[model samples]
Target chain A: MAYSEKVIDHYEHPRNVGALDKNDPGVGTGLVGAPACGDVMKLQIRVSPEGIIEDAKFKTFGCGSAIASSSLITEWVKGKSLDEAETIKNTQIAQHLALPPVKIHCSVLAEDAIKAAILDYRSKRSPAKAAE
Target chain B: MTTATATILKSLAEDRRNAPARPVYLDYQATTPLDPRVLNAMMPYFTEKFGNPHSRNHTHGWEAEQGVEQARQQIAELIGADEREIIFTSGATESNNLAVAGVARFYKDKKNHIITLVTEHKCVLDTCRHLEQEGFEVTYLPVEKNGLVDLDLLKRTITDKTVLVSIMGVNNEVGVIQPIKAIGEICRSRHVFFHTDCAQAAGKIPLDVEDMKIDLMSISGHKMYGPKGIGVLYVRRRPRVRLVALIHGGGQERGMRSGTLPAPLCVGLGEAAAICKREMATEAEQLTMLRDRFYASVTRRLPEVFLNGDEKQRIPGNLNISFAYVEGEGLMMGIKDLSVSSGSACTSASLEPSYVLRALGVGEDLAHTSLRIGFGRFTTEAEVDYAADRIVEAVQKLRDLSPLWEMAQEGVDIKSIKWAAH
Candidate 1:
């Protein structure tokens, strides 16, 4: 499986790799993909008061494609609002990374991480709405 | 820094980047580079001595037949069988198919049962599956956690309906050496035929057909530093083991396999077998030392590195290990200079981890994190050290990027967390 230049670049030098304070009110954490399934991606987003994603970080235990997917999503989400990030499709990521057919799941995981993080952030802001 | 020093460093970095050096090959179980001596011995047969072994009219045919016969003798000598018992096939897959399916179909009237290990090669398992489709009952015996078949279980599995027991001499994935002699004895006592796929063991380990009582054995040329596209199946002659021919036309190889034999590949396999017979002892010792050196270096420097198979009962050239919390494919990418095989699902089209590792009771996560490092006859001490260092470095790098590793270090039980399955 030959990785594209972008995937190789992100794998070799992953961007925004670290953990944010999961307990922080501003930080929304999305942990997706099962470890037993050979991938576990933890993508975190720190939302600003103005509703922008001020910072993003990710840590992934998976193949080069999964790590690259997470790394690329982190970079893409950092400057976007929650709504903008939620609109990011997995196909766009897959196309940009030139991932092969089997590796499209890595991009799907990245998209799921974004949605999960946004949901977690929205829930933290309005507990009543989340309970409903 | 001085401008001159910076210029030199930049050039050196570029030189390193542009260098087309081959990756240090550590996947010998997959295939081996053809030995120079074997190639030299095959060259004459390929060019001037080209003749169909089945053709008996001219000197050309006689010369090719002589080469094929010599190869048969050499291969037979390696496993303590007579030259007449050695039958040529396309490769190990064909040989395995011929041995398992041929024998079962030949004796299908009296016996409808076959026995084989769960950890046998895909070819063997698929052949058994095919036989099952044809109404033959196959008992897929499970192996112990150490990757060895339970001898007691084998004794109980044989019945009057059983015709053959096919087991592998050495595992392709984990490098576990099965007790062929014990299995053979059990089969013999039960009045059943025993077959073993010795592709991974032929040139690396000692095999005796007489002592082990192996009725049918498969050998691959490429796995033992010979050319590809040629293999041997040793059919015991004294007890008169019989099999229906898989291919029929020219009646070559005693009608077991019928095609014009490639004299070049035959000579290559012959020379390779002869070389292995002469040098197996010293070669195995050297490989063991190199393998151990690699294992020691990596394990000493890294934490949570687990060996995947029986440590002492495995082949000297194979080291299958799992770097905890590090995905195997990602680790392979990190160490691009080293060639290795991963048990991770990402390496294959399917999303399942290696069935061989799973059969050995390795956890799914560990199975996804395993790497099979094969050290061959040409591997050097320096190469081993370099590979070990690269592996240690890659594992550390991947571990740092792993959330599970971080959580484990913080005293959080990784299993306690509910992971969303994708």
Candidate 2:
């Protein structure tokens, strides 16, 4: 099957590749899944004290589906708040790429990574700040 | 080590030394080196035994005719087909075309839809596509990742308009075996003619024409230590199916394909089948063990390699694997000592990755990296092991230089990283 042009785009010159320091209060890293063909994604968002994502970086291990999903997730999570990123659905990624049924799991993985990264960033903050 | 094969390579080397300008013949799947014994059996016909059984006027044709009959019987016995059922053609492609086009054209008025799979040999796929262009509605069934057709899909796809279904017995690239018997039974019940391209499996596997309920099947001579340019199409006489002729003129092959038969090639084909009948069991067993050994060694030495197809349900002589980072041509260039193919022999020269692998949901990168290693009657255990080592080392060396491997090493989930399109 010819990869959808979007998949090809993400496969070459991937956006937001490399690591974010999870140790910094500004950095929240989300690690999810085993890297055994099931796409595993590590998304990190550097958040401001006011709760907006200031920066994002990600790494993905999987097929074109995995690559495209993670790539789409990184793009989606960049400027959103923690709650906003959590609201982003896997369906959106699938719909964007027109992912077939078999590769839908890839989008789901990316959505999960976005949530995990937001939660990672949220857990580092104070309860008062979270409630706010 | 088999003494027979150990000496063959040396003889090959001797020939290379003597004639440095000769073209190296590596296209084994297209045909094979005819055994000397088969050549001897056929030689008498060219000389004193020359005769046409059809010519009642003289002994020359009669003597030549006896060899043809004997060879026919041998071929029929080889596939466990009835003697009257085996019809000869120029090669497997012709046989395949006849089986498909013949049935579709015969039932042209009654049925318009034909079913075939995407992973079939080019001949079968092309014929189906050609039929489609001719206004026959064709449904190309998709194969699963392991290269086997989903039976439920087959059951669901057949309708009154469906006149036939053709699926290859053994995939030429991935080496996966389809469930032909189950499919044949399904088609038989549906009254749809079932055909299989058995070019790779005819001599390698146990094929009984009646047991599978196959309506038509294609076989090639060169695939099984036989001479090239001769093939067999097994047309079951039961219930009487009809296929239109692809070629016209002489009224040979029961008016299906009319051409002057290549006597020597046909005789060689029959002899090849006979030899396969006598030696298949032992040869298959040996090849399986060697293949297993090769896979184990290669996969162990190089971690994270992908073995394509249903590992358990493939031909005993075939091992196809996709090394993660190294491309096929680069690895092949590194391992120059051994000769093999990257995909189906017919399409290897094209820069495009095989259409068969693409149908299996394989991406372009991994698909191009695939290599098909086939062990024939003469491939010895030592060669398999040595080739395995060469492959493993080449993969390792290539991986060392790859950025993909570096990412995997750094615990960087490359799958999570969204890559941009090139």
Candidate 3:
């Protein structure tokens, strides 16, 4: 399948690829997908005191689409508030990357990673608010 | 290991700035480009001599008939068969169908059982499945871990009711060559007709109908650098192997496959067969060297990369490998400039892994990461070197991003960890 220029760009020069300290209270780490299923993405976001995402980093084991999806999301979620980041749906990621139907799961995983990372960060701040 | 591969390819890339933008074609198992000589032989038949081979009255018919008959002879010669035994068909899929279904249906009254390998092409497997619906029993025999069919198991599976034994000569995905000679001997002793799908085997390897004791064999034109839409089914004439015609009309191909034969395709196949016969020795040597060179270099630089099939019995042009901790599709993407196929079913319409590799007992993780890198007669050493470097580079890059690789490096048993469902 022909990857879109956006996917090619992200795959060739992926942004924010690294690991964050999972033990940090302000850091939320989302490890979603599986190696057996051919994709496993670790997306982490460090939230500031005011609820803004201070930084986002990701590492993914998957096809170009999966890596590109996670890489693209890391760029998208930074500086956004926790609530605003939660609004980042998979469709928007899919559209932004022009991912094909076969690679749509990559975008879904990216969206899930964002939410999961946000949840991890929120739980550290206020355990009662982590119910969602 | 991944870094080493990338380094090799990166250096090669520096020298290939002016190279063609298109990815190098390495998936020869899928199809091969037509040889220029074959094209030259076919050009006249396409324009000047476009007459139906079955037409009897006109000069146009005679010319077309000559082309078709000559092609039939050329194809027959490749497999050491008489010209009369060759039947033209649409392609290997149809040829396989005619052999599997046609043989079983024709002998259903006396024999209702058929035996085939698990690694046979989808067409052969699906055809046998269709026959099962018709009440004909089929034995899908398992292959050894090396991807070779068990001759003893095949012998034990044959019963008095067995009419046909269908096995592929060389696997398309792994390129392991089956023991056709031994299998043929067992089939012959048991009075069961032996049919081999030689689509991937035809011009790449030497095949003789008499020496192998094969009753029916399928040959695809396009796989051997011939034109598409043309194939040959070599039915044994000495023992008189008969199959119920799959396509019935106009009594063409001895009433086996009835259709107007394309003269150009016939001539192209003929020329291709002749060229293969003449160049098989040198081509095989060159391709084998190139294939091994690529394999040795990749494995030398890359750790945790495994070859999928038996190294010794495999086709010289095939080099299937699995890069641990990296998905095949992702690796393919990392090396977008190189054309290859992943064994992972995700690359296909289905989400399952390759059945062919699964038959060899390869783990699901390895299967998902496998790539089928095929070399051909036209492949150059430069291309092979470039491909090896690019693959290494991609595998390294993908591995760098893989969480599993990190765990493996840290001595963690990845299998023991429970993965999150989402």
By descending TM-score, how would the candidates be arranged? 1, 3, 2
Candidate 2, residue B10: Cα displacement in angstroms equals 13
Q: Residues A1-132, candidate 3, lDDT per residue (tens digit)?
A: 688999989999999988888999989999888766777888999989899998999988888888999999999999999999999999999999998898888899999889889888888888888876
* Predicted candidate 2 versus true structure: per-residue lDDT over A5-39, tens digit per residue: 78757755467876777689888877665422323
Per-residue lDDT over B1-422 for candidate 3, one digit per residue giving the tens place of the 0 to 100 score: 24444565577667678675778899999999988678777877867788888899999999999998999999989999999999999899999999999999888999999999999999999999999999999999998999998888888899999999999999999999999999999999999999999999999899999999999999999999999999999999899999999898888888898888888999999999999999998999999899889989999999999999888998898988989999988888888788899987664445678999989999877888999999997899999999999999988888888878877997988888788754
What's the candidate order when arranged by decreasing DockQ?
1, 3, 2
True contacts kept of each: 0.83, 0.00, 0.65
Q: For model 3, what is the error of residue B250's alpha carbon versus the real structure, in angstroms, after optimal superposition? A: 1.0
Q: Report the lDDT of model 2 for residue A95.
A: 88
As a whole number from 0 to 100, the lDDT of residue B392 in candidate 2 is 84
State the displacement of the C-alpha of residue B323, model 1, in Å, after optimal TM-score superposition: 0.6
Off by over 4 Å in 1: B1-19, B347-349
Candidate 3 docking class: medium
Model 1 quality (TM-score): 0.96
Clash counts for the predictions, in order: 0, 26, 4
Off by over 4 Å in 3: A122-132, B1-20, B347-349
lDDT of 2 by residue, B1-422 (tens): 23454466568668878974532233345456776557656666655666655565787776666677778899888767777788888889999999999989988999999899988888888888899899999899998988899999999999999999998899887889899889989999999999889998888899887788888889988888887778889888887778888889878767777876666677877888888889999988987787788888887888877888887888887777777655565456556666766642212223356788778887665765677777776666777778887788777755653445656787876566654321
In candidate 1, list every pair of residues with a backbone clash: none
Error of 3 at B294 (Å): 1.0
Score residue B244 of candidate 3 by CA lDDT: 93
Q: Against the true structure, candidate 1 has what lDDT?
A: 0.92
Candidate 3 — which pairs collide? A63-B330, B2-B396, B5-B393, B6-B393
